[model samples]
Target chain A: MHELSIAKNIIEIVKESVEEKDLSEVDKVVLKIGDLSGVVPASLLFSLEAITNNTELENAGYEVINVPFIVKCNTCGKESNNEAGIVRCTLCGSNDTGIISGNELLVSEIILKN
Target chain B: MSVITVERKILAKNDEIAEQNRELLKQNDVFTINLVSSPGSGKTSLLEKTISLIGSKVNISVIEGDVQTSLDAERVANYNVPVVSIVTNGACHLEAKLVQDAINNLDLAKTELLFIENVGNLVCPAGFDLGEEMKIVVVSTTEGDDKPLKYPKMFRNSDVMIINKIDLIPYVNCDISKLKDNALLINPGLKIFEVSCTSGEGIKEWCNWLIENVKGKYIHQTQLVY
Candidate 1:
């Protein structure tokens, strides 16, 4: 699964960051995954556990925050959370719109002990 | 015991590597295209057809990315074009770092067009950019016409949507209009092409479009030079 690949990336990033900051140990990793980002949190978490088992992040835990999809209505100029597969404006019922948010997949914060 | 709060993006590292790869390709004057699709969507077949049509017109090279096996690379090699196969070894997508390495091993001096055929997965490939100038997402009629709606990100990220296996449309239940509509809804300006690589149907127009676009970009760059 792609989750494994993404997990590898996460591990590599954490490893580099810890080395750069001279951190002794990682406590927890906080991530924000958007609804439209095409990543499954559970799958990523599982992969992360396996990948970090023998690495510096062996005992590190993960905290995932799910972000809802938000779109800006072109007709009404209103932004609101949107359900999956639905891109129409909630207020004006128009298909003219732009994606405002919910496509992000980022590590928001990481907790480390020095 | 001091706790440090590191607010960092997880993909930041990968994105940084991707930017470096982009710069390398730009400096080489190589136009790269990342081809993505579901398994058995005829991605390789389309490449074969593409190679046959434009192999002599331009300098083409391929970076074949797959979880395993060198089957696709071998196919492209028969066209006498330079090919480098990168086995992800079970990974679903190709990352920028991998492409960077592949490009380093390639002869970019004679290469004008570089095609990176990503692993056959609709969802995962969209999240990664391999320093490509454009992305082409292939969807076969046999895979259902609702794929564009189900996987909006892949379609939206793609510059061109190639509808392959059009010959199977008569034997299968597919609505071309619905597929086009859904894809256009996600990306209104997406260039669309329908072709059957097996039957050589509607492939001439597709090749013509590709050649024209590549030539146009090259000529535009020439104008900027003068």
Candidate 2:
């Protein structure tokens, strides 16, 4: 899966942070992934586990926070759920809706040993 | 032990490199388009047809990304254009680092238009930016009309969508309007084009749109430089 590359990215980010802190041990990493980010959380976790082998992240546990897809209607200013793959506003029946969230993929936190 | 809330996007490194690529292309007055699609969606055919029609008129170069083959690069090189193939081995998308490396081998000073054919993937490619002026998604008539709904990330991120292989529409159980409607539902402002590289129908209009967008602002910017 392409999640390996994303896993690599996550490792790189965590490595950089760990290096900055001069800590050889990292405990945990928290990532926030939006439902609409196109990354399957399970696939990413599997990829992350594989690539983290024997690295600074190998012993580190990770968690992914799923963010809900939210979109605002352009015509009626109503927000609605966009997780269904169809992005029409629920209240307005208008297709002109802009997604404000649910595409996020970020490393939110890293826990390290003191 | 302590928790450091970093709140950093994992793909930030890719984005930074993409911005650099974008600026470098802009400085060279080159317009770049990242063409993304699924396997067998006819991205190569679209490029070949475009090159055949306007290869003489414009100085174009291509950066081809594939998982394991340079065959696409070989096909594109036949047009006598500067083409570079990036074999990602097993990667599903083209990252900014790969594009940066690809551009190093291209003669950008003489190139007016650049096309980076992203690895044939609709899902992963949508999340990576290679610093293109626009991201175009090409889907064939054979792939069903609901592809946009299935691969919403690609459709939502793309600026334009090309419905290819229109010549096969009569034989397949696909509706051209259904594809457009689905895409519009995901991205209301997405510019859509329909064409058949084999039959050459609608190819002219599609190429014309590319030429206009690439040249219109290019002329103005170059004149300013002069």
Candidate 3:
């Protein structure tokens, strides 16, 4: 799965942060995974756990903040949370809508151990 | 005890490389398309058809991405076009760095359009940007009409959706209308084309649209240059 690569990417980012901040160890890594990001949180967490084994991040807990897919209808100026993952206006029935959120795949925070 | 604020994209490295590629392609006046699909969704077949139809009118090059083997590259080479194959070894998708490497091997000056046949997987490729002008997702009738709904991210991310293998529609359980409806629901702005690579059904329309796009890009570039 691509999550393996994503997990490795997260570790790389964390490692860079650690080096720059002079942190001893990582306690947890916080991620913001959106519904439309095409990433499965469980699979990504599993990959992180497996790869972090025997490494400095072995005991680091992974925190994923689930973000719902929301869209803003340009026609009606109505915002709707689309659980079905479709980008459509709920009120004005306009297809011309922009994604308000939900495509995020970012590392928001990293907790360092004392 | 301390929480470090790091609001950064996990695929920032890839995105950076992708942006570099976009700049590079723009400078070279090369219009690129990243073709993505399931393992057996006839991506190669569609490419073969596209090349054959438009090769005489325009200059084309190809970068074939596969987990292993140079089979697709060999197939594309039969058309006498400049082709490069990127064997990911075991990677599920083609990253921007890999594509950047492939771009270095092609003659972009002579290439009007570059077709990157991405590794055959709908999910992972949707997330990775290879600096293509557009991403085209191919879905065959045999895969069923629910593909768009099942893999909404691919449909949503793709600018163009090519419904391939329409020749098998009579035997398959897929409803073409339903598939279009589902895809349109996910992405209302998607440009769709239905084609049968074997029967040469809608290849002309696809090629005409492609040529128009290439010409449009060329004209835009010329305008900027002047």
TM-score of each: 0.90, 0.94, 0.95
Q: What share of the true interface contacts does each candidate keep?
A: 0.56, 0.84, 0.84
Residues B58-123 of candidate 1: C-alpha lDDT, one tens digit per residue: 789999998989999999899999999999998889988898899989998798888999999999
Lowest lDDT sum, 10 consecutive residues, model 3 chain B, at: B217-226
The docking quality of candidate 1, as DockQ, is: 0.52
Model 2 DockQ class: medium
- Candidate 2 per-residue lDDT, tens place, A1-114, comes to 779889989988887777744445788889999878888989999998898787546778888898998998899998887664568887878987778888899999988876
| Candidate 3 accuracy as lDDT | 0.91
TM-score between candidate 2 and the true structure: 0.94
Write down the DockQ of candidate 3: 0.81
Chain A TM-score values, per prediction: 0.90, 0.88, 0.92
**Interface RMSD values, listed in order for every candidate:** 2.9, 1.5, 1.0
TM-score of 3: 0.95
- Model 1 misplaced regions, further than 4 Å: A18-25, A54-56, A85-96, A112-114, B1-5, B220-226
DockQ of each: 0.52, 0.73, 0.81
* Every model: Cα RMSD to truth: 3.8, 3.5, 3.5
Give the per-residue lDDT digits (tens) of candidate 3, residues B1-226.
8898999999999999999999999999899999999999999999899888889878999999999999999999999999999999999999999999999999999999999999999899989988999999999999999998988899998999999999999999999999999999899989999999999998988888888788786454222110
